[model samples]
Target: MALFGIRRLLTILLIIIRFRLDQLIDVTRLPSWLCILLRFGPWRLVPAPQHNRGARLRLALEALGPVFIKFGQQLSTRRDLLPDDVADELAKLQDQVPPFSNEQARTLIESALGKPVEELFGHFETQPLASASVAQVHAATLNNGQQVVVKVIRPDIQRTIEKDIRLLYSIARLVQHYLPDGRRLRPVEVVEDYELTILDELDLQREGANTSQLRRNFADSDLLYVPEVYWDYTRRNVLVMERIEGIPVTDVAALNAQNTDMKRLAERGVEIFFTQVFRDSFFHADMHPGNIFVSRKHPERPQYIAIDCAIIGSLSDSDQYYLARNLLAIFQRNYREVAELHIECGWVPPHTRVREFESAIRSVCEPVFEKPLAEISFGQLLVYLFSTARRFEMEVQPSLVLLQKTLLNIEGLGRQLYPELNLWDTAKPFLEHWLRDRYSPQSMFKRVSHRLPGWLEQLPNLPEQLLEGPRRPIEMPVPNTDIEHLERQLQQEKRSYRWRVLGIVLIGASLMQAELAHWSPHTLALGALGLLVLALK
Candidate 1:
């Protein structure tokens, strides 16, 4: 792996020089010694960059292979973070990677399905409708005359992905070991996450399940359309799903011809994003223009058609709550609450002074508010917010990084679709509504209802614990070695449930004696569980 990594790194460096990427870096921003190294690097012989730096960068990444191409795909979304020319060039990095042999695709599909393609589908196209790094999709019609696409995994891609991932780890390690800011950057963990995400995409069936889940999430809504997964025809290596026909989201001219309400369409996009992130917490992490299209049925109130569910992002309950609160506070200009939320969520160092952090936040946010320009500046506001986060010694949470990337992508997308789109206006109402719904009495009841089964599952074993709770050697009948072995095993497992039940019984006794009339359902549950344990014993 080391030798392979070294060779691969050297080759990447060669490609970088071929594209004259060294010219892209502002060496003046680097330390003096690093600047010296750049001037004296092995590829200094390459000609200087002429123009189209973004194109050159994209070309280099494509040459490097799928892993690098994925990086380019992410960079393409953050137009606010990169030069406009470069972002435009990288945005052209097609998700449709060059296709593999149709013959190979058929063979894999046959192997996965235990039948020839002809037996399953009425017709399978020899050529793929689309190809991507991990898989390709061919247009097909089922025997029942349903139009669908057959998604087949790229041939022998696991080894290639593993090899590239190893190279990434090696590179991350080198940076972490050699640079002062390496730990702060967390290269190894980032590469690890990338590795997991890319590998998960290799499972076609998993993507199918994601599609099904998203479809269910918005079953009653028309804002976003998710293709239906044909489970009978799906496998881990091959997935079959309904095909969709819609105008590409990026085709502004096509949409305008359709008389789509641009402002409503743009706002709907924001609504979909927040709905997925905060409401469901299961968002399509990849929402680039290529994977999204505009449905034609509702031109007056535009709906979206989304595909490619290979990469999904989710947040924990705590993250979802804090993130909502943080965004709300940001809109309200409540710097102190924002700072307290950060500390409460442990996003920043606990030892950090709240007063100083609040002041720093006020400094960053107040400037943006003072600037006055509306929607176009929302993206700029995020850039400032992230910059402030980095400065306050806040440890960037890996779990939320996908959410961060996705929101930025959505921001860039909304701004492009409708320049007059007020992102905050669309988002604030949704956030407020979600927060209100989250704490409503009905919602709290639903939350308890969802978790009740788990607590109930632990109760059956509580009886066994209670029966054995008083098995003192002095009180027990003489035991054989088998019984002794059983006793030992039982001792290991019976630590908490028995004593907790006993404590609950004592509390219930006191409450009943005191004639407390309003014992809550929660208290009743504890008393009932204790009674069952004691009865069983």
Candidate 2:
């Protein structure tokens, strides 16, 4: 297995060299590259000179396959780390790839659903509607006379991905060890992240489940629509879902032709983003133009359709609360509040000067305040804040990073559709409303009502546990671990408390001594008694 793994690694390296990726970066120094030429030998180089080194590097990765495309997608989001041109170019990494043979697709569907394609669908197209590196979609009609789309995974992709991931890790390690900018970039960690993302995207069943959960999250609303997953026909590598047809959000001309409310559409995009982050905490991280479409059914009040649920971002409950508060603070232009929230959330170092951080935030935001509220971008505010906070030793929050990136994408799309869209106007109300809902009495009641049954069930055991509190073993000598740790802390606190009490008592004794200077013995005894009481405790 080890020898075959090494051989597989060499094959990927040769592919990389054939595309001339070695010239784009310092590759011979990379162990994977050395492993390649040493085993696979004299490589052929493809001439791609129109693009600069960075662009060529991105293009090469795209050519290498889906896993690399996913890596490029992540790099595109790190605007602070990469140059504008490189990040911009990487953003164009298309997920499109040639589809595998239809016969193979048929076999996969039959194996997963335990039925022949002919029995499963009224009509299944041999040609796919769209093809991505991970999966290809074909329009099909279910046996129940419902229109749907069938998504089938590329054949043997898992083996290919596993081979290349090992090589990627080797290169990432070398970059982190030798490159000056590698530590900040965290290449090895980034590769590991990419590994997880690619592996997740491979599981069509998981993607279907994610789509279903997100659909449930917004089932009552018209803001966004997630296609219904046909669980009866879904499998690890194949998914059957409700087919949706609408103009892509990028098709500005089509949206205009349908008389879509551009202003409302743009404003609602901002609202949906905040609601998903602040309320649901689960957001479709991949909201690029290709995956989003605008509903023509409601041209006056446009709705959004979201697909591609392979990547999602969620915040911890604390992160969600702090993020909402921080956004509210920014909307109010309360820079101090923003700074305080950052410290409270541990976004900044504990010893960071709050005033200094506040001033830094003010400097970044004050210039933007000069513009109309409609013109000011929340995305830009966050970008500047992140840039400033990094100077204060703020660590990156990986979950928030995706939200920030998706925000920028949504903002860009919205502004292009409607330049006068006031993101602040749309978002401020939503944040305030969400805050009220979170802490209101009614909300608290609902929470308790949901948990009361479980609490009541466990209540019977609580008194017995309280009566028999600290459990000890009968067979072994007890270790006073709790007392030992508490004793050290207790001693420090006791010393401080003792000094305070002693100082107050001494002051009282001095006053008594002053008043009874002529007959001091009786007053001195009273003072001694007071001191004794103070010491006894």
Q: Best by TM-score, which number?
A: 1
- Expressed as tens digits, the lDDT of each residue in 1-537 for candidate 2 is 688777866766766675566555454555685647544555443443576766776777776677788788877887656667888889888887888889999999999899999999999999999998778999999988999999998888898788778878888887787655667667776777678778999998889989999999989788998899999999999999999988999899999998999999998899889888988899888889999998879899899999989889999878888888998888788999999999999999889999999999999889988998888878867877887888898877778778889899999999999998888888888888988898764464344346445545655665564444434445755477766775566566655555434534553554446445833656545544544555554
Name the TM-score of candidate 2: 0.79
Error of 1 at 487 (Å): 32
Q: Which stretches of candidate 1 lie over 4 Å from their true place?
A: 1-7, 22-42, 52-56, 75-92, 179-184, 376-380, 453-537
TM-score (C-alpha) between model 1 and the true structure: 0.80
Question: Ten consecutive residues with minimal summed lDDT in candidate 1?
Answer: 506-515
Candidate 2 off by > 4 Å:
1-54, 367-371, 391-393, 461-537
Question: Which residue pairs clash within candidate 1?
Answer: none
Q: Candidate 2, clashing residue pairs?
A: none
Model 1, 1-537: lDDT tens per residue? Answer: 678777888998788788997776666656788889987987787776666778888888888987678756755644333566886798778665789998899899999999988999999999888888888889999999999999998988887788887777877796666555566556686676677778889888889989999999999798999999999999999999999999999999999998999989988999999999988889998887888999889799888999989889899999999989998898789999999998898888788788998898899888777754453355456556655776777655645666766777788788788987788888888889999999764465356446445655656776776877645454666558678787776676565546556654544443453346654666555555554554554
